[model samples]
Target: MQIVKYLKQYRIPFSGLAAGKHNFEFEIDDKFFDCYEHSLIKKGQLKADVEMQKQENMLIVNFHITGVIQLTCDVCLSEFESPLDFHERALVKFTDEDWNQDTEEVLVLSKTDYELDIAGLLYEYANVRVPYYSKCAEQGMNQSCDPEMLAKLSSEAADAEEDNTEEQIDPRWDILKNIKNN
Candidate 1:
């Protein structure tokens, strides 16, 4: 995967680490988002702190993300920076040929596997923190949305709602409705 090359630093080779809790830190930049073609975040700066707990049979990874990400406003298509802060945890268990991840937070890996590549996990955490609808603040110090675009979008939405309220029927469908009425 293209991500593997850029995020090679995120790979945690636990087979050699002594049984204990270990901490690793990394700084994520815009280049990290380039790995995914359809990523919502094309540019960002973030910090990640990963805490790995090694046990006899399983590994527990705790992730903390904090920083800012560049996003395009859905309302005006203007770029803005949004703060990102979240925590996520994952459980990795070792097994042989029985990789079952029906549990959302748990991952199954081969018993012989020596490392865990956490690039995907970090990406997911960052993506999850993004709001479904990102818009520049209507009233804020950093409000930078285009007024014309916002007005256009509002007018379009109002027009759409008006159209929905007054449903149009095709002539063929009208005949069917009349037959049912009779």
Candidate 2:
């Protein structure tokens, strides 16, 4: 895919790594998110630190993610930057036969494979950590939302609630209500 070119740097060649820990660092910017056609992250600046521990049979990779991303607030429709920090670990093993993994944190690759493509894992891990309802940072602290939009939305919601409070009885349900009263 065309996106592969942008993520090529995230590949780690594990065949030559010594049986020890190796560290790699990456800076994720706006261009990184451009690789994905549909993504909630419109703009971002993030730092990724990967620690790879290689053993004779298995590999352990730990990712530390920290940064800020610009997101559209669901409540106010305003864009704001939110801080991010998360840690993810993956266990990878060499396999002789092709198989699908049922585990979320484990991966199996062919013995002949030279490098591991970590871009997909990093992308998933990062996205899953984002809050579903993004709101302005100030709103979370009880400061304020977008004044004009908030006021309009508040008025509409109040009207809807008031309308719902005056309930109309269906003819079928009215008979049941009379029976209950009797």
Candidate 3:
């Protein structure tokens, strides 16, 4: 059985349970990331805990995602690990008619089957927990960033801005050299 299928078994009974709070937990690791193709993550240690309260025809799922998501640095595009820490909530309602919704947090279920599989829900919440952009702290800024690359960029910009007099200009920029000093 697939890891996600674990939720399918509890569908009917859990849905019919009296209005109360229920809890579920999941562990995320490198193996989970490998399942996805071209995953940006190389390694991960995430924990997802969901608390749900059943009320009449609706279920409120509170997803708490926290841990470390091993991903490359966005700035330097180098392998780096960013911490994951966030919380999100969602509501699932059972309706007779399929209502088109405009949000990720609201879900409608069929009249026949009121049960919902939280695997997809967990995946989405985990994704949302990750910060869209994480910058390297000053201490770690240059750690992943290639020193040579930064040096090259610095030198190029410096050379462009310098007061390149005709005497200082390289032969290659003869036109530019004459425009300034001559």
Clash count for each candidate, listed in order shown: 0, 0, 0
Give, for candidate 2, the lowest lDDT window spanning 10 residues: 136-145
Instruction: Give the alpha carbon lDDT tens digit for every residue of 1-182 in model 1.
Output: 76667888879999999998999998888888888777777888999999999998899999989898988887699888888878899999888866655376998888899999888888878887778888778422377788998899999999998886666644676777899988
**Which regions of candidate 3 are displaced past 4 Å?**
1-13, 38-42, 129-134, 138-182
Alpha-carbon deviation at 108 in model 2, angstroms: 0.5
In candidate 1, which residue pairs clash?
A: none
Candidate rank order under lDDT? 1, 2, 3
Stretches > 4 Å off in candidate 1: 1-3, 138-144, 148-182
What's each prediction's TM-score? Answer: 0.76, 0.80, 0.66
- Encode model 2's per-residue lDDT on 8-38: one tens digit a residue: 9989998888899999998887888888777
What is the lDDT of every predicted structure here?
0.84, 0.82, 0.66
Q: RMSD in angstroms, candidate 1?
A: 5.2
